[model samples]
Target: RFPRNVQLCVLSFLLPSDLAAFASTCKRLVSLCRRDQRLWFSMCHRRWGSQTLINKWGSGRISYRRLYRILDEYKNLIGFWRRCGDSAAPASSSPPPVFFEWGPSYIAGSRVFPSKNKGYDAMIEKPFLWMSVAWNRKAMNYLDSDGKFVLNEEDLIGESGFVENELIRVNVGKNKITYN
Candidate 1:
């Protein structure tokens, strides 16, 4: 049998579902899988180490396992996204495409606009949405209309059809987007 450290290293490589299944095999493994900080922290670091500061997330108040769940749930959103249907904003105020990025303590969506320069094909990013864990460990999403990180309580509907006061929910499917 491998030593505890080695076993934990191996367990760190497993998906959460697989680890849960393995943990059910015996009392020893169940205890190890449930209480080992290194295993869960390693799992988070391995997946998102380069994109974000894993340790700084949740302000050291939440467990790494919970943090892992939060990151995994929203990981697919870390890229450019364009609305597929009719415009959600007024015709006179057509909105630009948006890009999502990772942050030390949150995931932010920003408005992307073409550069004003004559020939430089660069895009500019303006902060639009900020998503982080709340005091209750729930997802807290805020929309900043002025891109100034100000938390406005007014119910503002963004170009993405998302409301400032509502939780941003997405239903991803294997072949198409579906919801339950």
Candidate 2:
């Protein structure tokens, strides 16, 4: 990036396609390459424009120019992560905070009595995951059936045996919190 015509500099020094091969050739190179975002970016971005490369270059998106850009971004030597496959598991950039929430009804031994509790309406019951992806640091949290902040309310209820979740609800005159 220092030299104005530096675009041409990488060609003589490091070709894009050769970078991955070079990175694999030795440990030092791999370490350098890992720090170099150009290779990783190319590897990642290559998946994006496959059709364009085939139409124009008749090959992959690999090129020397992109490699230098990656080097510039990664040369400082910081952390890098490479995903081997589709990572479906939940991931967070930062460790989650120590959290405690209500335990589930199964652990609480409080079953919604359905028709037995005619005073209440058990019209519909289905489970869905509501996440608090908008936490203080933009993290994910889940909301339970009653639209509470905590996904599991068992901890909030403690060992007290409440038959229905609404019984403990702070709203609608159900604030009868009692512990077993």
Q: Put down candidate 1 lDDT per residue, 72-180, tens digits, no spaces.
A: 9779888988765575777767767779888766787788988898457887788766666643576555556456554333332333223534443433333343322
Candidate 2 lDDT tens digits, 1-180: 255234323423554457668678778666555554454445433532332221112012334244334323322322222333345665653322222211221111111223545556642222222211111212122224443333243433322223234433221112222232
Candidate 2 residue-wise lDDT at 136: 20
Question: How does each model score on TM-score?
Answer: 0.75, 0.19
What is the lDDT of every predicted structure here? 0.72, 0.32
* Predicted structure 1, TM vs. truth: 0.75
Q: Which one wins on TM-score?
A: 1
- What local lDDT does model 1 show for residue 48? 92
Task: Give the residue spans of candidate 2 off by over 4 A.
Answer: 1-22, 48-180
Give the number of the best model, judged by lDDT. 1
| Separate clash counts for every candidate | 0, 8
Over 4 Å off, model 1: 88-94, 118-120, 149-180
Candidate 2: clashing residue pairs, number: 8
